[model samples]
Target: MKNRIWIVCLACLWLVNNGVFSQEVSPRSVFSLNEGWECRPITTVSKKALFTPVTIPHTWNTSYSEGTILYDRKMMVYQRPLEITNAMKGKRLFLYFEGVNSAAQVFLNHRTIGEHLGGYTAFCFEITDQVKEGENLLEVWASNAYRTDILPISGDFNICGGIHRPCHLIVTGQDCISPLFYASPGVFIHQENISEKEAGIRVETHLSLKNKKEGLKLKTTVTDADNKVVANSETAVTDSIVKQPMLVNRPVLWDGKKNPYLYTVTVELYDGNQLKDRMVQRTGFRYFSADHEKGFFLNGKYLNLYGFCRHEDAKGKGSALLPEDYKMDMELIKESGATAMRLAHYPHAEPMYDLSDENGIILWTEIPMCGPGGQAFTGLVDTEGFKENARLAVKELVYQKFNHPSICFWGICNEILVSDGKKFVEYDDPIPFIKELNGLYKSIDASRLTALATCVDQSYYLGSSDLIAWNKYFGWYKDAAPSASKFFDDCKNTSKGIPVGVSEYGGGASVNHHQWPLAMEDRADSHFHPEEAQTFCHEGNWESFAKRPYLWAKFIWVFADFPSYMRQEGEVDGYNDKGLVTQDRKIKKDAFYFYKANWNLEPMVYITSRRFVKRDNPLTDIKVFTNLKEATLYINDEKIGTMKPDEMKRVIWKDIKLNEGRNTIRVEGKNGRGFLSDSCEWYYIGK
Candidate 1:
């Protein structure tokens, strides 16, 4: 039976009806309070105890767990007590948390102010009322254990707990910009014809007002990077919602591959004479569409989307990543020769959106609900709690990161309801829960495409998404490496009607430093070693196992190997060595070079793997994939030959010349796609 219930009042309605005076505040922080938060474990006797000491940018699991901790272990809570200082006395004070895994409840001097359910989205609370004169006690209770109410009760990877992100107290003016506001630089700019010299530029801006009585006036300006204003407009506040329009005589349209020129739109909010807030958003003046028949098109040009799925996990820091970390990741991604990224599983941290915005990397961001489990569908969807949580997640994500130009698609769920156990097949009936979720996303943000990652089941569930994405691990998990071509053929043949995208594919490899020929055996025994002889011990080669899966575009299970305690064995400890980079971020496995050969566009040098090498095998068959106009391959310092990159054919370079000792092979390519080069060395010995 279908059960229906309204969980919580709409947050906007709640804000208006509460009788409390609303204020507009800037989302940007003036001070860095994230560094000084004092944290501790929440105990049973005191649901809001303040005993443990920790720092900001800290994860509860990394410090608490000595080794790989099982998911079924005891429930843990993280609490942080903050003291309000004189510098933050009069201004409107709010507590902002980038993220909290699973469930979090906030308290000011022991009084419950607000609580949040989802772990991937940002949430804030106005704590001006809870503060004392001199100092204020702020406490946050975060939990990551299994709960029927939580959406992700079961899945791969450890649910590293705590305030797995930075927490801060934002102080702003009485009429400051609200932290939650959607900046839709809407499809104001439209182009009629492409080859023509002049293009039409239409601008549309939406400004949200928190304090209705304050009444806002908006001033918009379009400009080039040189700071010269191209067009400008001014409008007075008539209603809480405002829309303004303007025209540019000749606009430079933004296109994906053919011509990728973007423009900047700046909107400023003013109260009488004082400037209240300002937002600068970058948007392209072009229209595009995606379908199975034509693939991806920008301004009437067909562009095949190629990229890898990125998880928001950083080395050493768990999920609590800083802005610099996001920048580094984006750099690596751009270096990989892919133009886009599928932020796998959930919407990433806000900084990632910022990085993507600046770097021109297209994004496919999804909600946190992932995987296939009975509790995910039966327990989560049927209950009122789960629905409310989902609603909040959508609202927060859409409102916070909507302005980003890089985010092209909003994915609903990961590979959830489409799995058929053996091979991929469709669900018997439409998962009403998913339908409701998709409806909510469409209602909130219809500007972008709606996508979902399913297993191999494209025929039955293609109707559920605007774009059907498949997560196939044929070469690694199911089939052999040599069968990759067959898998691709199966994918193409089966996904005839749907606009298909390979969402995930890749294998694991341990680091050279951590690599011992006997390490895999040690790891198997340590993790899977049971108390009784009935326990079965399985042994296998880890490196050769990973080499077989590096064959496709949506490849690479992970960019780096991370810590995992579940199902571990032997000397493996807590590490899952499936990444191109190692856990400590020091070494690159051979697979990294294989991908570099396939992705890197510049003429550069890179060492693939330092581990096992075949004796006297100086000439390694290096695979170089490029979108450049042409590419040149060289062995040692000598030039070899040129080649072209074709979407239909995988580029493979065979029998490159190598020296007897340590020979380096390099390839350089250039075009509008930019320059790329890569090199690797091998030792040779002869009788």
Candidate 2:
């Protein structure tokens, strides 16, 4: 017993010498603070508000039902209780907001902590000094009101209000990786040089040390997909920043949709063998470039980038999307065999970038410095605050998403310049601002390319960025269906040696509306949107785009329908119906299969106008979109004729006689793989 007491005394002395019994702290503790919140709209500062329980991924602007869309462009207050336990007292704390619309000011225990401007990107605040021991009140004031100083002064899409994303509370040791650097991962793995033979990488780590102790070290390790350690380095953390160099031999490239290779980078902070913090970042090595005449090349191989534009707004959720929604969208996109996607007009959620990385889809992410469509021009303001906010937003976007390999183009602006201006055009030239944004992006990340989208034939803006694309809706708005093909010719003639692309095309389509003979007389804003006209417009536009390999990229207007408070077209009000898929993602328009047949390599067939079950003419054309070499049309179980697919993968049998009553239509297609057939029913009334 005496000997045991002596050993215990020695152990206590050793523990006291090492300071282990003083206070305990973990490496990093992160948890979602997405529940138990109360929100209330603030109409006026003097009026008292009634609070309602709400979730984090929420938007007050979206009308989930069939009522009028109440765009609540007002301030809202969200309050929740943040408990600080005794075990978490000594550690540093941080509050991270993945997204908050327009602007937000955070308060802890009725004291102002921090504020952030910009809706799309993320922001973080160090709350180590603000919290108490027990339950503490955390409040956020978010507003989506039109701010001249903020970006997206006016846009085609809705600016949703409230915290429309996830929130998290992060706890870490006094010396750990800093999440305050533009709300980034604080560890950036830079690919200095990459090739098949060797890859030179540099890992930069940003640190936050409250008690700067001597003998602090930073260790960076890189592991391949198989969890095999490829490279590692240990360096002394002299300052708040540490740089470690590594080299990988014969690195596997991240080929688009072919081999999406990834490498895991782990960064750990240590103080004399005691770990303080750890962070993990995923990275891939690939190089890409766009040739003015030869199109885009990825990793020294030619690749055709054909895909669709995407918006964050959905039917009921508006811009408040969950991870499952993102996954569903990616599954649909990948199923279509698309190689790229343009995140239109603004930066999307972080999960989207991750999905793009995982799915090997190239991305074009931009800021929401959108201009008015048509002849209006009120998107940009010529104020110092506005310019500064724009610049800050660009910086935040680049820094936060710097590590994603899927992002190839940093789109500066969208339609910032139109044909005519309602206000003073001299004050908003937008060329200088565009050039400044391009330069700023190059200054931060010169590895990627800069691009911008325009709506007019302003060749002067072509020199502003490395690549330029145009958003033209000639078939729908200009009353000329063939102009969709002619627009690319005009672009080719006046491209001035810069890589050009078609950023936005295709018109609105309502599945419930069908026209026998397609007509282009209907305007984009009209209530009568025929589904056949949209399919015809896409057919013409895609054919033209396919013929011109010089066009570096081609992105259809949108992949899925999204809510737009400014719209009242088609069957649905307050929504943009140009998506290949419906707003609720329940149906895919006929145009979706047109691209799938042209792009996908799988053996699949789809009969066009399947939703148009009633026919007015007894004699009609049976069009089928299939990847097979030849397809034969059948009516009432009788074969009509066999025809090969055109260059656009469309097989048509003209003047097929249909039965007067109920007619069963089927198309049997064949390629080298096998045979597949699609059937549909059409009721025909003899003319």
Candidate 3:
């Protein structure tokens, strides 16, 4: 009993010195304050409104149904009780907001701590002296109203208003890893001196000092994927920013769909051998670049980056996504055979980048500077407030996500020409601002290439960024049926050695609608925007991509249907049905199969236009997508024919006779391993 008491006392002393308690054993430095929060919209600030229980990964937008959902545009306050115990006496306390729509002001015990603008990025406030040893009141004022000073003042997607992300109460020793700069993972690991044999790993950590300034030891250790320590470095704290370089011999590169080798870097701060604070960062080493002549190259191997853009939103969660949601998204993306992603419009949750790193997915991440007209170029060319805010947003974006290896492009601004003064085609140039943003990006992160997404007219502001991407939907909107490569070919001629990419493309599709023989190229008038038409669009567009060598990346407009409150075009009420898959992701449209057939190295076959189950004509074309060399077709248990895939990886039996009532069609193919088959049932009612 006496020995047990001594052991307990020693353990208590050790934990006290480490600035951690029993409740925080899992997340030693961070405690998720996701539970026990009350929130309500604020009409009158006095006495505040009575609050209902809510969780952190929640949004008031979820309370409204499908078409009834309204963008509140009002300020809401969330209050919760935080327990600051006697154990956390000297440790610095930080209230970390993962995300809050538009703007937010944090208060600790009725005292204003700090305010952070821009809803996408994470930010924190130091609340050391503002709390008591017991329970304290923590309040956050969040709003999604139109802020002229914010980056995304106007956008197609609704800016959900609330603490629409996880918040954490971080406790750190006086000499721990700093969350000072935009609440980032203060430690950034840069992969340098790349080769097949050896690589130079540079670890940079920014530290925060409170009562104790010196006599601190910073140790950085890199562990391989197998949890084997590869390299370790320790140095005495001489400055706020510490740079420790480690040489990794025979480094395993992070190859896409091959081997996503990762190294976990653990940064620990110790005073006299007692652990003060610690932070674990997951990172990988790889080399990638986009070429003007040839497409993109990874690890010195040329490869085309084809994928889709994604929004950090779910069915009911708005943008208040969980780690599981992100994980599922990654799994879906992987299943779709996409090698890369464009996290369009805004910086997503941190776990997204981590998942991409683990799954070997390349990424093109950007800020929410989309759809042209904002305070920056709304009639007047430049507003001081807008410029400063834009700069700050870019700074936070680059600084916070600098360590992720999956990101290859830091997209500066997107489709600014929409708000280019008076006209969409011709207006005040936002190139200066673009250039300023690019410069700001380069000032902090020189590792990745910078880019801008343009939709209106690339000629007006294409010269600002290092690389440019076009969100052109020529066939769907105003132009003739694709010749999808036409615009890219024209741009490539005048690219002036600069790489060009197709950032956003493709038309909407209603899973509820279907067309016979696939809609024509110019199907814009097709109000329902049939699913087959969407499939045809993707097929033609990918054919163009296969023919062209200049288009560096091809990201479909979106991966899944997303909500656009003011949108009234597609079959869905308030949703943009441009996704290759349905909003719920329960259905993968034929367009999704077309890409998988061409891109995915997996063994599978799928029949197109299966949703067009009721055919009026007995003689109709049957189409199937397979990466297999050839496929055997059978109609109503009778072998029809055996054919090879065409230039588009499609096997089509044209004008096949269908039975009178129900027609059973089965297609079999040989993959790399063995036989793969797909079957669909169709009703042939004579017209």
Score each candidate by Cα lDDT. 0.58, 0.86, 0.81
RMSD of each: 12.3, 4.0, 4.3
* Model 3 C-alpha lDDT per residue in residues 278-380, reported as the tens digit of each score: 8888877888888888989988998778899998778878888888888888888998889889997899988999898888889999988776332233422
Model 3: weakest 10-residue lDDT segment is 372-381
> Candidate 1's C-alpha lDDT?
0.58
Best by TM-score: 2
Q: Quick one: best lDDT, which candidate?
A: 2
Q: In model 1, where is the ten-residue run with the lowest total lDDT?
A: 531-540
Q: Please identify which of the two predictions, 1 or 2, would achieve the higher TM-score against the true structure.
A: 2
Model 3 TM-score relative to the real fold: 0.92
- Provide TM-scores for the models: 0.74, 0.93, 0.92
**Tens digit per residue, CA lDDT, model 2, 515-627:** 86565775677888887888888887777788788888999998988877678778878778899999888999998999889888988889988888878877777789988
Steric clash count of candidate 2: 0
